[model samples]
Target chain A: MQTETDLVTGPAPHWHEGVSIIDAMQDVLLALIPITITGILIFGTGALLVIITCVTGAVLGEIVARRFKGEQTNLGDGTAVVTGLLLALTLPPTAWWAVVPLYTLGGFLSVAIFREAMGGLGRNRFNPALMGRVFLLFGRTTLVYLAPYLIDFNPAFTPWLEELEVVDVMAKATPLLRVVEGMELPSYSTLLAIYEGGSPAETSALAVILGIIYLIYRGRISWRIPITTVTGVFLLSLFLGQDPLFQVLSGGLLFGVGFMATDWVTRPVTDTGKIIYGLGIAVLVVFFRQFIAELWIGYGGVAFSILIMNGFVRYIDKLTARRVYGQKK
Target chain B: MAEKTFRGGIHLPYFKDLSSGKEIERVPVPEEIIIPLKQSIGAACEPTVKPGEKVEAGDIVGDSEEFVSAPLHTGLPGVVKAIEPRITGTGSKIKSVIIKVDKNFSAAKPDKARNAEEVSKEEIIKAVRKAGIVGMGGAAFPTPVKLTPPDDKKVDTVIINGCECEPFLTCDYRVMLEKPKELLQGSKFLMQTMEADKCFIAIEENKMKAVNNLRKHNTFSNIDVLALPSIYPQGSEKQLIQAILDREVPEGGLPFDVGVLVQNVGTTVAIYDAVIYDKPLTERVVTVTGPNINKPANLLTWIGSPVKNLLEKCGGIKNKPARVVMGGPMTGTALSELDAPIVKSSLGLVVMTVEDSSLDVDDFRPCVRCERCIKACPIGLYPNYLSMAMEENNVVEAEKWDAMSCIECGICSYVCMSKRPIVYLIKKAKEKIQENKSD
Candidate 1:
């Protein structure tokens, strides 16, 4: 019979046990549930289609990549599904259905080639969802020139507000555009409407709120990054005399804060680093909306700015490393 | 003063309450004790006691010529059963001497529990060196060499690191709270050996009760209690000095470079025991508690005891333990085998079951270049670039990125939004680059 004995020194742990990365990913997925529901309610079936297409595309891409590389597939972990869902949230609500293949390829490229193939989940420096979205953004821009030949028409050229049905107003006005254009504060009642914004993930502020709360409660994401990001945007907008409410509600702000900016793979690992990352994303978002107001340029600002920040992740970590005990900084 | 801590350290759920306040309990010698020849960081000792030999407690069983190594002692008076190479907690092979306990054998009670009578500083140093003591607070660096600073440098102060700053660790706290007299006596011993003018017992504010206990022990005017802000790695040499003395050990330099020597409260106690009891470093204080265990206590266990026995003693697993970690949450390695023997410097044996399920490993995507890692790094190193460089196998670039400086604390990976394992990249770079240099 084994006897219970107290530990005296030898190695650091007398016994061993720990939680796996798969469990952590599940918590993150649970957190996204609220935001996902909000996006679906506001954008109607289009939002749901985008989420389905992107997630399916990402997971399939992962399976194919792993099979090709002679590695075992792990779809049950739910990471690929979360990446797809996050990518869907960053798109325009009226985004063309063509996003399905483009985002799918992007997700696969990020997760499989850039992430797993390179080093597996925790090793990649770039955010897979953002990378997939960036690919779609780049792909869309290419389609603009080749769109007539490909589809013979462009839906984006149509005035989105005029095309929306009465119920669609809830999804017509994206939070970002409102903040950028310096629009008056929308009432909580208006914000609650499902189809108030035209942006893919921004229409349902209520859904995003639910999502963030879920993420926090589930421990998938830290409260620090999203909170700091929104706080930074709020503070910076105020310093420039931009309406704080408009900034908070505008253009993917909620969606970005709730989901995109909080991606555990791409953000900082230190608490202070997360705060800096949030502040940086906020500052860049405000800077682009305030100064450069170009149609294509501003749409990609968050992704672009975040990409730039990701490049300096190591530097940020060093700058913020806690002072070693018994030593000077 | 600015709060001191290491960057990227994990805030593991410290089940310290299980054993934090309890007196250290000595486990009876089991039917057999598996004593490994190599326990510390340096060379594995050559077995001095043969199989079938009857050895007394405190007798040296293994000795090494390596300067950075410590000798191993027999924890029980028994007949050696066999000598064989076996895997230890670190997953390395070392020669182990197995001794079958005599059912009638009882631990000889220590002669007297008394502080050291003021011996000459030289005599104390000789005793410490002879007893084969090392830093028991984790690093396992030989303690005598640390106490004997270079002749060129003058020492002014000695800081006793009572900051069991790592989460899930309370062995030092137990030493300070229950063995206060010995802890103080150890500090006094170090002060005399180093010829230091003052000694500061730096404890984190989170451990206020332990700090209070040490202060009330009435050791010496020079030995003062300092309550530091609670933070991870606060007990690190550089951070501790900064917290107490406002001094910095130059980067890529030793604590002696800063005119001070830092010792853990546990180490000081070990020193006191070695000199007072004439015992070599054999047994130590270990914390055995986790979510799955029925009981957690600070166990005074003999070195080289199989961890599986300890877990069985703690009522075994309540559920399938997620992973068996050999250290604190941040820096500990997950154990792959239960048969591995525990060695010196085992600060904690945490059975962490609940993980942040959201942070699970999925397919990694491209880095979006968010500087969250940069902002989060306490060491001021850029992880993103280091990772990029590492991905490209640009060891030269990784070096330029200061990849070597990363302590692999997992903070970068912990707070990452994209869930990138920035720590792994840095670790790979460090190991690969160091290998290249060695070759």
Candidate 2:
């Protein structure tokens, strides 16, 4: 491709080869396509409705937040959309308006507080989506326990839920919660398939596997964080005399590790740092689920590990930076 | 098979195919020349020739009593048109001797023997110094000065760098292919002067023919020809030394510190010209090729010859040059004025197109902390952090990240996925450090 060019003058090498942030965001979206399809197949139209509402809400929230700050919204870049989708994928299926409004608030708060307020895009010390989700989760927990369920006391809503014939599933705890309560778990075969015990994104392990393979092969994500995170959980399970396979396959561990914890901005860029960060997340995930779940603290699950580690990411990066080449010891 | 390699280097699209196999074309003597006195890396030379003075080719026009500086020579038999400051291709306006060509030209007569075996160490240095031979690998350090290492240092090996790792520049490759005999004789002269016993002609794996050519003609008992692992910056002195000897030149140290002397393939030929024959440094083979040019070829260009002349001789701009770099694309300076004169060490006149440079089509994106720059850096420097420190105006942080150690290779910027302009930050950081020191 040799054509006469203008007197092009700039830096040395006079060449640039790199992937844009938009390209990487699109690659991430492409990786989740198969998982989204599987979620739709497993949970019917409810999964699609929930995802669509959350994505739309996040985009709207981003625009609203940007407008408030007298800035143009970067909705075209798809970062806000991706954040919303990530939040919705991990959320249990709920009323579209119910999840969307909370997600919208979270999205707005994250962009305003965590990202822009702290520093712009690459400068943020925390992953906006997970930080936003954690903020809402803790806020809701305080509202629920301290205020003693003021909002859920609506009599009309109960009657409507009764008409829908979904009260039984809502009243009884999920299989994982019961297991934490020292009850018998589901059979191994049932655990392997989708039987409604985890988040919307984790419904199909097969789908997540396919997505992770695609993302890793395309160089959009490194295999270090995901593989090492799972290894940490499995190693802890083995030490605790638990079924390592069941501990790893069930819950949202696969989806969270394969996608969420590997978020580029939230993790370390060095190989040593990445491995340490992944292992730390695994230990925290197991600690909260196996031990903290017994106390019925429903605040965070697989996501709690990611949220907690967000604080340590900067420290881990500093601690593990590789010695610069030819640097004398 | 790939030979010895150092860690962390990039593979480049070496468009040597444009002229690697082509023989050097002897450029017709130019009508005018702008020979800069400060072309070498040491102290600037004072003009020795007066305006309107008639001078023969190989005549010294500028020199200094400064021990480190190399003298400048006239490349054509001409009358001095002017003695004034002029712009060189490297973007410097140094004192220059502008010579207008005389129709009937005569070369200076050689008083030294052509046979390399008869030359003694003192004779070699004297001839090299008189000829004003500087390193032709683009550094342009005086070659005679390098031969005399500090007495306390124990020098052994003399590595002749045949690895022209910079892409689209095959002047060194052509020299090795076309002048293997002279290169070998030049290495002998170098060893005799340096008192070095072992000789290793390090060529990259890509030029297997040059390697075989050098190997076949090498008659010295102590010399061995090796194919270096094909990688960008393989021709880098410290990296090349480390690859062969597994020695690390101490931080802020020279190759002589590690008991080795390094010289580029082109410099060796110049050494051969000066030592074996009493020829002064004047002309050098420069690769003038790119997709934008009508014809891509290597030309034996005279010193002070305008780069535009070399480009026109190849085939003037096919369309419009996308970029006209003064050296290799990786580390060369941009040429806005195509008429800038090529000085002593000018390696190539790279006339690349817009597609080759890949500019203006995309904007720089924020660094995603992908660490691709770290992976691609041959120096193992964390460009991500260095760039961050620069942005924050934190010189202290940059120092901790080893900012001074950056070699300005541009590989960090090249492989950066975010197109973060990492090297620019390093340059700024270095500038800031120097400013702080001065304050």
Task: Score each candidate by Cα lDDT.
Answer: 0.69, 0.79
For model 1, the DockQ equals 0.10
Model 1: residue B112 alpha-carbon error in angstroms: 8.4
Give TM-scores of the second chain, every candidate.
0.91, 0.96
In TM-score terms, candidate 1 sits at: 0.69
Deviation from truth (RMSD, Å), model 2: 3.6
Tens-digit lDDT track for model 2 on B1-439? 4457776888888888988878999877778998888988888999988999998888899999999999889878889999888877766577789999886856556675666667789998998999998989988889888988899988899999999998888999999989999999899888888889999999989999999999999999998999877898899888899899888787778889888999999889988888777888999999988778888888998999987788768868876646888888888888867667888889998887777675332345556677677777777778898988777788899988889888888888887766677887888889889899899
Work out the iRMS of candidate 2.
3.5
DockQ of all models, two decimals each: 0.10, 0.51
Q: Interface RMSD for each candidate model?
A: 9.2, 3.5
In the range A1-329, model 1's lDDT, one tens digit per residue, is: 32222222222222222334556667767666766677666566666766777787778877887788777777776778878777877765444445556666766675677667755665667777777777777776787678745333345554453344223322344555554466655665566546455555666567677778876786667888778878888888899997777667756667776677776666776667778888888888878767875663435666766766776665676577544332343
